[model samples]
Target chain A: MRTIELSDRQEKIIEIVKESGPITGEKIADRLNLTRATLRPDLAILTMAGFLDARPRVGYFYTGKSSTQLLSESVNKIKVNEYKSIPVVVNENVSIYDAIVTMFLEDVGTLFVVDDKSLLVGVLSRKDCLRASIGKQELNSVPVHIIMTRMPNITTCKSDDLLIDVAEKLIEKQIDSIPIVKEKEEGLEVIGRVTKSNITKAFVTLFKKD
Target chain B: MRTIELSDRQEKIIEIVKESGPITGEKIADRLNLTRATLRPDLAILTMAGFLDARPRVGYFYTGKSSTQLLSESVNKIKVNEYKSIPVVVNENVSIYDAIVTMFLEDVGTLFVVDDKSLLVGVLSRKDCLRASIGKQELNSVPVHIIMTRMPNITTCKSDDLLIDVAEKLIEKQIDSIPIVKEKEEGLEVIGRVTKSNITKAFVTLFKKD
Candidate 1:
């Protein structure tokens, strides 16, 4: 097998394809701010190299040798810390109404419930807030802790945990995100979070690596 | 790379690992109704073959080259129809009360709203019911269509769409599941549903194949 190092354009193209594949060359060209004629060489190279598969009218799909190797390397080599985003934190004592505002403001599906010391205590999801706020009129008086999934029950990942394992935990638990915590004397410290979006980012980076 | 054919027992072990990895051989044996002693050889073979990775205290994880290949192939080869589950359907005219009951009974996160002719019209999710039911006193009179995401905006997949592409759609849309539909004279006929669980199943099957 010939190892053809991908150029920046090629890498960017692969990233685009990975994200919204079964896409056309025209669309790919549009995303990269390039004309179809300018992208022909990269398209030909990617499709021929098996990094992409193109049907006559169906456009390009990511069905390549790299898909296998990249997925393998991602599972084995990438760790939770590598992809964890800063966790959206909220105090357990905060009113459910306040928590609702925070959740929407942060644009996160799940919020890490923390104590004053920043110790991870529980998790509040969109469903929890929505359920709690509905049917009642006391959103302000209701504490978030009442609706949160408390610790020791929440699925968490340490910084060193494999990305593959974290992804598995996400699927197994059917949760949107996993808090990346540090086990401390006080409790688990919420340093970061790994979300479903992180996995998608990983997929893009898998192709981005030259 | 040596292509070792997996025995049925080996395949089952891989399945268990994919579902819940970092599992101990003793646990695997217990689940399969075999003694730890009897399962040692298979575990050893798998570990030695690099299909399973074992740590002193971490137990076993699926870390094979095929995991990458399998993930790639699973996404590329498998279509929405192949692993799509039976969809939960409800008539658009059904009361929110009736829809809520059906949602619980079917154990589904979303319901396909169909017309009297069983043509897909809209989709209702757990959030929809939760939101509509809250602050409302007349679930019996309120119809589900009021809260549902109507068609032309619903994220859907055809039976022939690749599983990988479908997974992308799920993440991009951040929805629970996508209805696998077939275009018919009536409209888009809901055939089945594909979910995140289906992706995990594909992951296991990738290793299960000989």
Candidate 2:
């Protein structure tokens, strides 16, 4: 797809069509005091760009679709599965100290906490761990489950979920990362992870790809 | 600007132009076994969209710009100043406990450390604080400068710098945020902060904008 900046006359034509749509090309040209031949290219462009729809007998109708709208449509097609990273998970019974070690060893901002069945139970952000580290309790004695953002409170997404929607969730919720999960008979199983880093990478990829 | 998918014929025309550009409309039409009148609209659309350029008598030259190239061009125009957040700062002499408290109070993932002159001297992430908290040193006794990532090690950006370039830096350095700084007589003054969150916001805004 190619993006084109509309000329003054083309904008005028859209304005006219929006006001008196289903009007013939000849009539649109007449309203602008231009010949039919002069407006052909502009009309063609508008029609092809999906801004205006043309009919043989009824004339041109304003599609009410703006250029930037297509940009969003393209972004909406991106799925979380395409950009998600392998989830770094720890059993909920693990010590906070061990969890912090896992986070540093994995070099990820967040970690998923799971049950004995390997079902997701909670999430650990660097913020959460840091908060726990400064607490009065000993880090080695405290289980991560005691401090993690627990289930029902944790924001989760599926692998097939739209990446843009997850990005929106990240902003709205003001969190660092989310666990991508899958449904099982017993509970939700952590399958992947999506973070602001993933979103940032996707953002960079948008401009880099041809 | 509006994005449009090119018709097969239009794509074919571009191929012809790419291979034997500066070829006249009549020549391109002849190669496709179509009349010049049939090709006028395609040529016009291509020229107006900046894919092909037409001269008075020299025919058309392929601009060598792909559709996605324009996407990057528009993205490159976004400046860091437009999306930066207020920089949360701490003093170098402040205790690590105080710095962690400042981080929690400010609710920012990163903090900029300043000297007695209130200029940037070091940077801190939650990871930094967590690491310090786990160490043998007492949080209230050790100064932040001892644990903070010091000068020449911190990544920084200017307000006027392109946001995309900063995004690349964030990915390359694997750091959460960068301090937006301005040069002073003695040191760099922290003006703002740009993080993966800011870049993520910018990505979402691209689609949401009209």
Candidate 3:
């Protein structure tokens, strides 16, 4: 993770720049009771940091905060727990027929398979069930465990982890969703789920006017 | 779309900082034959733009280039043509069985469907074929077009388009891959394909040391 910070003097300089539109360095220096040479550093710092904009003769004006900075800032601060949705889980013993209905009812492309202990054991996608149903296979008899991508293959995220890292994992792994889980006394218990949909929702909110 | 430019003086200041470790404003001013005030703006710009680092008492030092800047820079330069993989294509009239074999043999989740004119007409995936083969349907007799997601609904990218936008579309639309295509007189012609794997590959390259 990276951090960007501003000192008290720097903050004050930004405020001054904000209040006075297109003010010159000499004027700012006069107000601060510092020589132009001494005040030069602070004004330069503010302008370079993107808080202030400088023209050849127009002096400095507030450029406002950049969208990219706001985005990176929000992504760093937002945690998975804040926006994660409920993980749609089905018992591993459930018949593919029952699981399919559960998936459709939940309107999810992937399903987390939990054992009787409610511990996440594996993951199964819509394609997995579809392929399992092929060749006159009986959907009522086949269990999801028979076709699931088992543990050690599953990728999970923590509740407190940064959202962009979770997003990076999603893109890197090419998986639709990640089960947000933690190690409980029993086992790996699913807390919530972060899917492409959740990330999309966050992206939509990023630039939206408050 | 925001542009950040480094002036010649700013670049020279960065070069000096790189060679000399943690030099002071007074020393830089002496070397540049400019007063400390005159050099303030350049130092501020360099530090603010992440080219340099500043501490009031410790003077200035180089922080090198930031990873975020490098990632964004590489993303801008890398187009679909550079990162895209050769698109796996199947004739629209081919049997679902043949298409399935092609898909599995190519180890791709999606296949571009081309008509007799060799123009992309649809897209086929394992789920599409699996669903069509249910209820006593024969894979040998089924044509991919019947089960495939047709054009006008398919998402595509151009060779020159930015790769990050492509990655976003892949996430937002929840599609596994996008066909990089060009418009021909007949229709859209598949040039290459950018899959989640391709994006992952590009991401892997991003952190690689030059």
Model 3's C-alpha root-mean-square deviation from the true structure amounts to 14.3
lDDT by residue (tens digit), candidate 2, A15-57? 9999999899999999999999999988988887778999889
Query: Could you say which candidate leads in lDDT?
Result: 2
Q: Which residue runs does candidate 1 get wrong by more than 4 Å?
A: A1-74, A130-138, A200-210, B1-75, B97-101, B130-140, B200-210
User: Which candidate's DockQ is highest?
Assistant: 2
Off by over 4 Å in 2: A5-66, A208-210, B5-44, B47-65, B208-210
Query: Please, what are the lDDT tens digits per residue for candidate 3 over residues B112-135?
Result: 999988899998866576556554
Model 2 steric clash pairs: none
Q: After superposition, how far is residue A159 of candidate 2 from its true place, in Å?
A: 1.4
Candidate 3 falls in which docking quality class?
Answer: incorrect
What are the per-residue Cα lDDT tens digits for candidate 2 across B163-183?
Answer: 888888898899999999999
Relative to the real complex, the DockQ score for model 2 comes to: 0.45
Give lDDT tens digits, candidate 1, residues A1-210. Answer: 112335688889888988998899999999988899999877875664567889999999887455334344434666778877889999989998788778657877789999989899999987676556544648879888888999789999899987777777887787878999888997899889987667655543433222
What's the true lDDT of residue B162 in model 3? 74
